[model samples]
Target: MPSLFSWLRRLYSLDTLDTRFTSSASASAQTAADTRPPAAKDARANSIAQGARAPLWRTPEFFVYYLFFITMVPLMFKTVVDASNENNPVYAKYSHLLSPGWVPGRLMDNSDAQYASFHDNIPYLVALLVAHPLLRRVYNLFSNRSAQSSTSSAAAAFDAQLEQRMQFDFGFGLVFLTAIHGLSALKILFIFNINYRIAKNLPRSYVPIATWVFNICTLFANELCHGYPLEPIAMALSPGSGTPGDQGTLLVQWARTLDGFGGLMPRWEVLFKVTLLRLISFNMDYYWSLDYPSASPIKKKQLDPAALSERDRVKIPAEPAAFNMRNYVAYLLYSPLYLAGPIVTFNDYVSQQRYTPLSITRTRTILYGIRFFLTLLCMELILHYIYAVAISKSSPDWSIFTPGQLSMLAFFNLHIIWLKLLIPWRFFRLWALVDGIDPPENMVRCMSNNYSAFAFWRGWHRSFNRWIVRYIYVPLGGGGGGHRPANGKPTGSPPPSSGLGAKLQKICNFLLVFTFVALWHDIDLRLLMWGWLVTLFVLPEVLATMAFPAKRWSSRPTAYRVLCGVGSVGNILMMMVANLVGFALGLDGLNDLLASLTGSYLGLAYLISCCVVLFVGVQVMFEIREGELRAGINLKC
Candidate 1:
């Protein structure tokens, strides 16, 4: 009991973790401190010219993981089939069409209609992974002679630009080749049978000639999603009515247009959806660029007053432009990350265009890639098992579940949801290495490595977090710790940080940011409930930290150190529980479950006791693993 009190006294030791997400430059510096240290050099590599060559592809760990992943494709297919619960399933077609002995037929030429449509992509993605690197290497070889002997400033500048990438001719050559092959794949695979259109209830049909007719509708259908005309109309009519007026009433119309097809569109429209932020970033930077010329082609063409809607024209005023067709095209279709992404800012995307990227280590990069690949495989298998065993609510074995089982279910379900993204996110980040660009890493660290909501947000989906920071948070007056008052700095003394007003503002801003993120993930009732519930506890959590600030107690006795260590573990466990609860439960289900926790005295006591045990056990587990408290294991960040 005294020991628990001791922990309360020294609780602030974990303050080195994630601070508030702020746009302030100082806050940015603090966030960097949380990132993993860069990889180290291998001395044996330096002896062979620049470096010892990485092992051949056959022996490489990355190659092994890829081979293993392919081996498990059958199991993945079976899981998908089982989850679908169809009378005549997709995988059933696979066995009928495929020959076991013939590997290519089994993998690619399978007679399965779905697989047949998808087979072209299997080859295309593989070629894309290799083509850019090999082509760039070839370009470098041929251009070495022509790059010498240029004395003019223009030539130097041009060479400098070329050095950032392979020569311009090759870049365009690769682009045209990819675009041709890409268009063929889209036409053959995506365009047939599926009703790709604005009308939601339209049945599937074959139309070779008119797919583009629907494509045009799909593009324009998005104007309604953005609340373009509705927002402008609402503003004109309502003026001071901050409520959702015409635009607010249209959410269902908007949801039906997008969310009705969200699942099918994840691999299709999701590419365009994710890249929208990059476009916004590009437009904003062009608007603000000091050197942008008024008469630039991009300005005259894309931002023409007649071309943009009223809302867009007002919100995104024309800035001078310096157009680079290659950069803009590549930014949109950066094939490695196009399917799913870490949402690279336009600046990072362009800055990486340089010909030389020093961080490309064949050995280290491949090793990291293999690590992610294997981790992803394990997580995916876990999810597959969980789905098979646990997802059916009406199963006859429902009586076998316990409260403890429900807790674990919550844990695994949330992990499954997050792992779905982590698996693909990691694979693409690895693939991006072939392009010589290290897009920002996601899921750098999560779960036990974090002990607070702030830390969790900072660590997970970091690229998305960055986009939110740059485009949303900063724009909305991001937690500026100091501010000049609009009402002119109340008469005498300045306001202090500890005041009730400041505290409420801090909590409000944090919750508001999280709500925005939740809504962005999906505009669903379940997610909205989760976001608000999680935010409810996080406010009190911030208050707890402020109340019991950490103290080192360096010269104090062993008991004090032990108390602090145990308390830190308790905090971590509690935080993770809240996260799982937030993510695990549905809108109605969460309310019922939370109510049951405290509805009975026995239930309340039992739940509290379980938490206490888990809290202390976590500290003991870490000590057993690391020989000290909070000794974090390094990961492939």
Candidate 2:
């Protein structure tokens, strides 16, 4: 077994295998210029990996940190537990699950329905995860045997066979989802088919507009109609089985029978939201593929499918045969990431089928698995001891807890939200890793470690952030003139004439990005407000960066660090308020929280103490990043 210290090192290290894995289509363009000999990259990697700085325990400054950590952690736990146990009705019901030994707190199953679904169906999920690869291997063994005698070059034959096998895999995935969703799966299929047809047949220019409109419409339709149930339609058509042996009655009866399996994944719409992202990815990729300059007839004949370049793999559109319905279906419904994605783009997903990344090694995967189980256990313990989620749902009397404890309620609740998402994303990603596909790691840093709103979003739901950047942010010209002309001339619009115009354009882009993100999460007004509030909170950091560019202060390290510390404290406070409003509490609860915090002198003192503690935490976060830098890793977020 690895030493405990080694495992701790792995846990703290930022350059885990998945962190280095690229899932964005935008990043795939770098693969085109990746001709630097492997040894050069390896040497640089080795130099960076040569040694780490002294451990935290050895650092003198960290003694203060250790003191703060040791004091604060237990106090926060006690605060959360004491607050939870204080006549909260949810705790009273689950008191039997409470333990009084070391951590005296009530235990209960998670109250969040989405997470509970995953928790409840672990046995089935595990069975599917186990059986999927075994079945795939069996299919591949026979496929390779049958394809060995094909009249093609060895590499070309292998490539052809892989695509053929993918068709089988994709078909199987559709069937599997259909089995679980019953007739409800047809709604997904119908939407997929429409998008597929649009990509294949529509003019390249129109594809983007059509794709966006149709998919966005489907979002509303899914919400309004609830995954477009077919059972009602079937019942109407059959109407008590008018003619027992009639073909129409038989067909309608089959539809009703198929609907029975809806219980397996009852709210299929939950999964459809994720599927919508893949749909956009596929259509947009297809649109861009159409725009790529095609090869000459001579080059086309000479082109060996297996000898394709990185540019060919990513940027250049594949042959019509490669983008067919079969592959499209497989890419959309690939079982592991089909539910909750550390979303991989269509191009990236297809490319990985042929060339699995070096990052998905057995050791790395095992370590990832260990990390996942550990996180799950941590989440379970938190749920058991701290009834924060239950407390939040039960509408407790907030007056019972002191200001510090009230703060912990929101604080721990956000952490629970973080873990709820992190555990599931990591679980599915682990499954993908075991199957030799590397999806992006969703949570690269702990929630408490972040001070910058922008950095927090980038690290949290990181794959989705990447997806937003690639599909939504960049295309809308959000980040520094996305897809601008190579010569720096503006294309579709006149240049922003003034500095204010440029800033406004950027802000508008952010609003749109967050709006879409909010709607994507769910079509709720509260989330929309959350999105806008996030945009509002990020502006201070933006202005601060403008005022204090790092290059301008390189000579005055002390002043720069001090300025950053102050700014981070403010950011932390703003972020907490924003998150509390969005996730843990609505505006009313937040208003009540703010009123309670500033309601009296003692409450005000507690608030100041909270800020001081957050400031210290931010310093540790900064040190953690510095440590990463010293060890040759720079996770810029």
Candidate 3:
């Protein structure tokens, strides 16, 4: 029993062995190999990388343990399927489809409003993807290149053509936005111009503050205005109300006409949330570029060459001319990433235009496509057989389920949520890959594989994680220390050294980041609570790792490994609870779940069994990671 307890703590400590995500693209740029580190990197390639060989099947103990886990998979499915069938007997007739001839399948619930929108728009996305390359080709053939110097060398001229190609692509994106959004595109353009002006016209010292205020306000204003209907404003400004004769008439007509044009994509704010992030990226990158000592006027050398590593290229500031209204507009409205992004920084996006990353090869992209389709098929299977989403939506009596069944219901629902997001992000990213742009890969690990909270967040929506780190966390002093401005005062007021103060600062930074994340997702109180809950959940693990720094006890291998295992069990439990509250079940549902588990003998037995199962599962997770390390791959998630 003591050994088992120690093993649990060891699981947690083992997780802390991985390095934190790198600070910024600039920090990466100083290194040659990384402009932006690939979401996953070769373990052999990075100095911090660690590798070990620990094959599960080689050890009898693990082989039995893993076999049990494998066997439980089908049982877990049946548990949820039984509960779903019991809850919705009407849908039980569709059970025949599961066995054979599963065609033209039915969704027990199509109530997921967000995914419904994406599903409806698949044809449109497909059309856009199909047309993108053709559009680029047309632009290359017909777009004037007379502006380039005819006497330039082959490399220089080729570089200029690529530069011009990006210009065409960016402009084309604006047109794409307009087609889908109609007059609402003007609203996006208006916000873009406002943000661009702030970045350009404000003093370098003042840009970050002004940009944050304006963009954050825009986000709130957008929600408050409900995408800012023009007709209502026009009605308020009508001549009969107060404004003189024809003065408001023409304005009213324009506003009404603009309102009419919004019919194509009335809910423009959905995409604008993502667009808002790009706005911030542009201004912030522009702000930092000004501080770059090497920044100079537009020059031919500013066009990044094919030879530059992605890390250096991403950090290298584009010339002053590149920040113009046209390019700024183009970058913000870029089609593939505009709706939902594996966000690329402004500098990174511009750099890719100069030369595609070496990683975006034909074989790799095709492989990615195959992976995406397989995952999509997996989602389809889950949707058809599990009906977790439908079951969750229906809100059946929770008390009826055995604790294990209830747990699986929540677990499978989270899986559905993960798959829904993963499929769409992969789809868009694959589209970008086809177009020779490599946005960061978003979901890097299975939801079940994660044991650490930090690792979970790092791997989940990974590009967004990087975005927050660079633009938000680094600026706030979560990096090595706070970034110093020209005034030489640290912005984040980071602790002078590591101790209680540093940990408090780190917690505060996390709170701020998660708060922004919640707000960015939506202006909902539930999400805000979720964010706070996640931070709270992360606290114990953070404190635990600090209290028992792995190195301090590394010499006592038996005791240390056991200690980490214990911590890992607790961390995994907390992570699952937090995620359930945030994504699968709400706070009330979680409360009910806990109450039920502790209320009765059966529930208590089930809960204990789950913990036992989780302990073994976490060990397997550790070994899987170890296997990856042996293979010279480390995702650092």
Candidate 4:
């Protein structure tokens, strides 16, 4: 097999992969350029010879893990939001399940259960995934025995053949999922207490069985239930919603009309949802793979037997997927991210699992642990503490705060939203990192120091953005880095940025992407509006930066430093204000915002004045720094 570098070169371009890994490189350079991180040089060398190892506890994660394991954490932390919990009828019934114990559950009534229906199932999934080491030991006993058998080589070859044959066919995928998940589905359906809660707190001995089944009937397999999933099915069964190609009514007609494409609108729910895109990506990337199964092969009955081509008789196959069922299942069902995901591509995941076994090091562990801790601090201190205080004071009364104050509220609120994502998302990403998968981090560095619209969206829920680019943007002829102009650009497409057509194409692509984001988030008008607001912001920001670009401050470090500090604050202001328009408005808040827009326009002027004051204040403060020149000296100079 080729080295990882060679494989990446084949998947993407030589430009995307480091030039050091080029085929023309000398043998020694090639060897050295094949760097796999989170692994020691020696450990990497022995990875093929040995097996995968376990992750260890480190800084921040260690603290959480230790507390969860040792302390009476269940009893220590309880947030009683409603008085109903004190007198709740279900509380007495499920009290034992929620008792302070290992993997404790929560007692929730009908009033508060909606929020947790999905979130709560994750802990059960996590427990099973955490028990993966135990499962591996059992599998190893058999694998070790197979290694000693004379027929092992032949068996491996057969398995390789099987992997190659199981291409992108929905029938095969459906059958695979059905076979794997059938038993667990029965358990979930038939057995009492074997529901989500019982699944989480299931007896340790029975966990491996249930978990294996869960992992096996995989989400990655069935290809998003063909005509999309749940929502579409409902729409199709509804009285007036026409079939996909046929728009039944005004709502359906308008939906199909939105993107100038019929499918994206009428079955808008299918296109507008978030999780569905991940499934769409899995299908697209799987089929896009080299030597994969072609679209549902023409049936034998549909073909004239005499004229049946060679392609009909023997199906073409993609390169062998190289996925053992065990590892494939593990990637699909890895618990920490099973609920809150930065979904890893199967190819990246399998490569990490098979070729790059992560060596746990003190430095790596501590670094990951510290990040986890920082995320915790941001979540607790900024979101829980600050947001709670802010939310309590916020109301519909327009006179409560000036425009400047509302803008400030928007800034803090956007940060709170990003921080909220960090809680579960960071935990999921950190778990995968410790295991050595390098599953793309969700929030990336956006929350830390993002300054531009491009940087902000790219950093937030980053994996999904990648999925969109790979499966949607590039496929739709949007060209940029890693994408060639000819990939899908039409014959009459604009030649360059100097042309009007080129600018229009850029705008079109921008709007389409954000529109998709709107749909993905929800079919809500506010979200679509939000998407457009962001699109407008990013496009101009990109153009403005490109047009009258800032001076390259490499020669003047102080000036550049000041520019950066100012830019950070500006970014927050723009980000928050846009979010306020698109998302952060309620009934009273909406009235207040409208009042600012319509009445007197004084609030708007106040907002502009406050921003000016803020910028000038920063400039003055920087100029007057004790180590540098003071403001008084600057007036003379």
Which candidate leads the pack in lDDT? Answer: 2
Local accuracy of candidate 4 as per-residue lDDT tens digits, 86-178: 243323333332322122232322111212232355475356445543444454455556554443575354443333222212223233333
Which pairs clash in the backbone of model 2? Answer: none
**TM-score for candidate 3:** 0.85
Tens-digit lDDT track for model 2 on 357-470? 644556667777888888888887887778777666666567766888888988998898899999899989988887766788899888888988878988889889988887
Ranking by TM-score: 2, 3, 1, 4
**What lDDT does the true structure give each of the candidates?**
0.45, 0.73, 0.72, 0.43
lDDT of 1 by residue, 1-637 (tens): 9997754433321211111111112222222223221111212212322321223235453365455446544544444334423232333432333323222322222222322232336456567678766766676567655666544775355345544363443354335434544332242223221322211123223231233245434444443354222334444454554454634435434533543332322234324445455555554343233223445433555543222321222223232221244455455556677666867665555444532233345644655555665665565345333432233222223223334434454545555556655666766777787566666667755343444456567668887876766555544445453222223322122333566666676566667777866655555566665677667767655676566444544355345535545555556555555554455444444445455555667667857755654444443333333311112222212
In order of appearance, the predictions have TM-scores of 0.56, 0.86, 0.85, 0.52
Candidate No. with top TM-score:
2
Instruction: Score candidate 3 by lDDT.
Output: 0.72
* Alpha-carbon deviation at 391 in model 2, angstroms: 0.6
Looking at model 3, residue 364 earns an lDDT score of 56
Root-mean-square deviation of every model: 16.6, 5.4, 7.3, 17.7
